[model samples]
Target: MLQLREVNIDDKQTFDKYITKHNPQISELNFTNIFMWRNSYKFRFGEVGEMLCLISVPDNDEPFAFEPIGAYTKEAFIQAIDEISNYFKEKNWKLVFKRVEEDKLDYFKEYFKNGIDITDDRNNSDYLYLSEDLINLKGKKYHKKKNHLNSFTKNYEFEYVKLTDDLIDECIRINEEWCKKRSCEQHRNLYCERLANLEALTNFKKLKYEGALIKVNGKYEAFTVGELLNSDTAVIHIEKANDDIRGLYNAINQQFCENTWKNTVYINREQDLGIEGLRKAKLSYNPVKLVNKYTITCK
Candidate 1:
């Protein structure tokens, strides 16, 4: 019998081994993402042959999975999916795959052999931007962003520093203050985000994430944490800025890329969760790609 255990920090190396081989583009495929949101989603995983099977048991919803992570052949991959599907079915839960990347749709078709319910998970799709575009803020597309960045630069005497364990506290403070201003406690998503951000910082060194923070007038007002998602791209896990500070979000976003991820070809800012305001903000940056995610119900 396959048994699933809650996702933990110790799972990073094992998950990384499988994830590295797969070189996944979807945001949820990473171990950091799995671990950070484990509290909210009640994520659990188990090993099945050469694959790692992860499932999310959200309190308010049916348990679901992302496509299994690892190297696989057609037969082995389909077998792994069947194993996971059975794991849920035993408990009377219908297994569905969430955040399945666009490229993997064919695999599901093969598994079903007839038809499957594949729906767009546009809300969870990640937004990817060219690193250079963010760094330079050039051209007509980025006109307003450049102006915001310019306004921030001109008005604030700010310092940008590479994030380290010692700087983690300041970053947490910034997030906390931001939460207070917005009354994050009143919002479920925001409250969970606070927990997730704390988890990330608490395990910053363990997870081996690279990050940067900004100081305006000797106080930290903004920060972001990210790590390499694949060979060509880096993914930002968390970014927070003080709402009172004009243009601070723009300042931190540009500087974080310039300082930490310049060598990477693309910066993945992750998902907007279908929030209209968030969608609009992400669109304003003019993402080069909106990585599509899907939810596929097995037949």
Candidate 2:
């Protein structure tokens, strides 16, 4: 059986080697995400050769594993899958892989005897956009976004601040207020997200996060957190803005990319998780591309 350990900040270096190399471009592959959601999702890690394997137990779903990260080879995946399957069997759980890239399905098909059951997990597909599109918002398609940003700048006395130790507390307070307005305590997923946000903010430095804060009228009203997912891609993990503040969303979205992640070619804002409003909001920006993801179940 593969020896799995709880995810921790200390494991980041070791994990990043494999994660960065694999560059799955999936949000879950980011170590910060795995670490922040560790307790909430019961995330655990193990290693097979140079590959990294992970398993998570979601409260509302059966325990599932992630596609092994690192050197992409048939032998490594087979070994990791077999070892993980044995681990699940001992616990009497089904062996399932979540967040499996659709492009990798053919490889798995060759490994399985009768082929695996692959399902389109549209809700979990990541929306990828050109960093330039977000920073510039120049073309006709971005006319509305430009208006929103302009409206915000013209109406409010606001400043963009780089996230530092002294400013994290303000961001946390803003997050707490946002949670109250959204009634996160009454919702499981939102509640979990709040917790995860807190964990990330508290351990922001140790997790190596880069973020920005928007201060309106000398008060922190919005914040965004992200990190380099790979050599050319930066992933935005969290972006919170006061909805009452017209154009705050557009402001933070544009400012964060312009200031902090300008060098990265692509910005991955992550998934919508089947929420209609969220899907619409993400699509409104006109993503340059969508990262197709899948769910695989081994028979």
Candidate 3:
């Protein structure tokens, strides 16, 4: 039987070593995301054969695991499938895998023909943007973005500071204020997101994240957090701003990319979760591509 354990910041080094070898392209592959949402999603981890597996046991949903990490050959994945199947067999549920990247789909077909069903998971597909496109905001496509940034600059005396221990509390305060304004208590997803953001802020340094804070009139108004997803891509996990303020979103988005991730070729803002407003907002950025994701259900 595979021994599973709760995910923690202490597991970062081990996770990083395995992650680097595999270099997954999906947003969920990042360790920080796993650590922060550990509670909300009931995440657990273990090793089976040569594969590192992450399982999500949400309260209301049927439990599922992510596509296995590390060097997963077809044979190794089959072993992992067996291990997961035995663990969940008592539930009388099919073993399901989420966040299965496009390139990895063929590996599933190699082992399970009639047992597996792979389908597009558009809600979880990641949006990929050119880092240069976000930082430069050049051409007519970005006219509105530029205009918003300009208005923010003209109206407020603001400072963009690299996030540090001293500013974490301020960021938390601003996050609370933002949540209150949005009535997070009424929305379960937003409320859960607030908890995840708090965990990230509390363990920012331990998680090895790079962050930026925005101060308008010398008060914290916005902040963003991200990390290197792979050699060529940086993934943004959290970005919150005061929507009431006319261009704070555009300004922070531009400045954060310019200051922190200029070396990367692409930026992944993660998923929109099928929210109409969020989907529209992400689409407006004119992503260069969408990293298609899929769900694999084993019957």
Higher-scoring candidate on TM-score, 1 or 3 = 1
RMSD of 2: 1.2
> Candidate 2 — which residues are off by over 4 angstroms?
none
The candidate 3 region of ten consecutive residues with least summed lDDT is 85-94
Residue 187 of model 2: what lDDT? 98
The count of residue-pair clashes in candidate 1 stands at: 0
Tens-digit lDDT track of model 1 for 214-273: 899988889999888999999999999886788899999999898888899999998999
Each model's C-alpha lDDT?
Answer: 0.89, 0.89, 0.89
lDDT of 2 by residue, 1-299 (tens): 88998888899898888987797677778888888889898998889886888999877888998888887888888888788878999999977888998767877788777667889899999999999999999989999999999999999999999999889998899899999999999999999999999989999888988999999998899999999887888999889989999999999999999998888999999999999999999999999889988889988
Candidate 3 residue pairs that clash: none
Model 1: residue 17 alpha-carbon error in angstroms: 0.8
lDDT of 3 by residue, 220-293 (tens): 89999999999999999999988889999998899999999999999999999999999998998999999999
Query: What RMSD does each model have against the real structure?
Result: 1.0, 1.2, 1.2
- Alpha carbon lDDT of residue 211, candidate 3? 96
Count clashing residue pairs per candidate. 0, 0, 0
TM-score (C-alpha, index-matched) for candidate 2 = 0.97
